[model samples]
Target: MLAVLIPLVLLMSGLSAGVLLGTQLGGFPLLAALPTDRYVHAHAFFATRYDPFMPICFVGTVVGDIALAVLAPEAAASGFYIVGAVLALATVTISLVKNVPTNKWVQTLDPENLPEGPDYEGKRADWGRWNRNRSYLAVAALVANCAALAALAVLI
Candidate 1:
């Protein structure tokens, strides 16, 4: 049971982390570069097109890994799983606390023109910073997950 679960989680979490890293590297820069209106509109456009499923996939896999960790039979193996889960969960927490509200604020602005009140550039900068941090966390979780899976593969 544990053997099946560990590898299954590895596949899911690894795929999610890989896609997230790519999207953050590839599309997020576009959001930072555009002017206010274009930035909002472009986010909407990209969210509708390129990102509709990615977030769901990422969250699902992270949650799946956590669940598997909770269910694992051995203490040492569970410790590695929990470490990966905590790192991945931190990324989720950051996304909810930082990214979502900032995104909501950005989306509400007029895409035809720069928004009034608060510094637009600063908001984008802060958002990008938060994203970078989350990306690093995701990378760490992915690495931890892979390591755990590899160890489990050898044991099982």
Candidate 2:
């Protein structure tokens, strides 16, 4: 029962992380195309939605990994747990430091007052790069989680 539950919880947590990171990354290109007004609104919405999830997911992931590690020591030592934890931490840092601040700046913009220029392009590119980095971390974490689950299954 413990064996089954641990992996299941970790898998779900990993899936949630993947979804959140993937959406943030995948949405960038679409967000880049929006007019200033639309971009501001979308940025506000994303900021509202994105900030809360990282901490929640980070806690869930840490708890899930710890639980799995205790339940399956052999698998834990295989480096999956370590890799996953690092990746999760990276994702949290990227979202909190890089993405959230950019979103806040976007929210401050007055669409009517703001001028179109190279600054917007530069900012968008920076945000896009950071988001892409977050996506990569998320994918790495997911792989580690999956590998751990497989190891747990085999041990069980």
Best by TM-score: 1
Which portions of model 2 show Cα errors greater than 4 Å? 1-12, 24-26, 75-78, 115-118
How far residue 106's Cα lies from its native spot in candidate 1, in Å, is: 1.6
The most accurate candidate by lDDT is: 1
Q: Which pairs in model 2 have colliding backbones?
A: none
lDDT of each: 0.72, 0.72
Clashing pairs in 1: 37-111
Model 1, 1-156: lDDT tens per residue? 665766666776676677668768787877877877777788666545525455665566577677767776655566677788888888878878997788777667677665467787787788888888888888888788776666556656
Worst 10 residues of 1 by lDDT: 46-55
Candidate 2 to native Cα RMSD, angstroms: 2.9
- Residues 82-113, model 2: lDDT tens digits: 67777877877887799888888887887667
Residue 147, candidate 1: how far off, in angstroms?
0.9
